[model samples]
Target: MTFPLRWLWWLPVLLLLQACSSIPTLPVAPTTTPVAGVQGMASYYGARHHGRKTASGERFNQNALTAAHRTLPFGTRVRVTNLNNQKSVVVRINDRGPYAKGRIIDLSAEAARELNMIRAGVAKVRVERLE
Candidate 1:
């Protein structure tokens, strides 16, 4: 013979648990060796996003060899290699991003053009941090 009021107490707790589970987690950057760098789809910034202040507090330069990585520390340099064309460019990690699903890095427009990826907008690549 439980009171009806007792069951209502669990409703708020259940809702809170559901809400916690729905929140997304921040992406963690890879800490592997240079030879075993992270691998994923790489995207590039467009003209629309140029000149904005990046997470590192520096203005984004579309023509610079810079990149936005979810977890790499600002000022860290990385070598991004395009597996399709075997082209590679070294870029400094000055921002955080590639927030889109499954992408690991976002390159500046100049970096993408060096890799011949401007036409594709995205590429399959490997990222190795420079020591």
Candidate 2:
């Protein structure tokens, strides 16, 4: 088999474009004020991640009322209310992402417990940003 040497230059450009496209871009926090709230599935992480560093450079504390949101700015406070149990808790955004598909937020263990959703592991909830 024979390869075309003249076409080699185009290969690098194509590869670079592909690499750029495949790199996932983190969602940017909105510059303007956000809406009052949003409703979606919420989940929690604890124990295993408790001592790890978060995207915001803080240690993850399962007992703290903290949470991860896709684009909410770090230090933003939000109230998450479980639709099923009618329980709610305030959590500070200290990380980025739920990571899991279809989930809107990831909460700390204490926040999950406060919402009475520890057993279910996930819940449908309303998240209201607090000023």
Candidate 3:
């Protein structure tokens, strides 16, 4: 049996719409300045995420003291402060972002543990870009 020509045209349109809807919308431009009082939970990934290729094309290593930022350029270093404990650690940006809304950054598992946030699975923190 032959399909109708009209159905063929509609198939392309449906496929296009599906593709567009499936893509997540990213911010047009991300803020570079430090966000104050923007506290939320922070989590880390290791082992599984390690050695994987990052958005910046660098190999991810959980022990490397690296991080992911929504907007910061790759290789940019930032100081992450744990608001709950007042502890902080410097991390190099080597990847994209937390991807979850309301989360600021994604730190290596070691980094999160350093801030004493491993138990909580999250921490309130601030991220400041450094030169």
Candidate 4:
């Protein structure tokens, strides 16, 4: 059974609002040079995801010195240092996220190895953008 046509107009508006609500909002990153440094827990992606396409539209290479940052512009280079051991490795920002909570960056396996964090799979890191 059909009701009044006037109510039909509200359907499209409601649907559009629902759709917009579901779209995730990304944090606004600085268009200028990045700030001093970001300190947070970091994680890594490796062989299991090797060769997959990254958010930057490039193939993911676990061996490459690349990383995913939530807000850094693609191709931005940053030095990630493992706070635990003071080991650091420079990685290009090539993707989007760690997805997991409490993590700031996702590193390539090679970067993780360079930072000596593979054993723990995660580490407290200090990230400083490269000029």
* Every candidate's lDDT: 0.89, 0.93, 0.83, 0.92
Better of 1 and 4 by lDDT: 4
Candidate 2 residue lDDT tens string, 44-131:
9999998999999999999999999988899999999999989999999999989999999999999999999999999999999998
What tens-digit string does per-residue lDDT give for candidate 4 at 1-131?
87989989999999999888866789986565546688999999999889999999999999899999888889999999999999999999999998999998999999999999999999999999988
lDDT (C-alpha) at residue 10 in model 1 = 95
Off by over 4 Å in 1: 1-35
Tens-digit per-residue lDDT, 10-83, candidate 1? 99999999888866789976563234477889999968888889999999989899999887789999999999
Itemize residue pairs with steric clashes in candidate 1: none
Model 2 ranges with Cα > 4 A deviation: 1-34
- Per-residue lDDT, model 2, residue 40, is 92
In candidate 2, which residue pairs get closer than 3 Å at backbone N, Cα or C atoms, i.e. clash? none
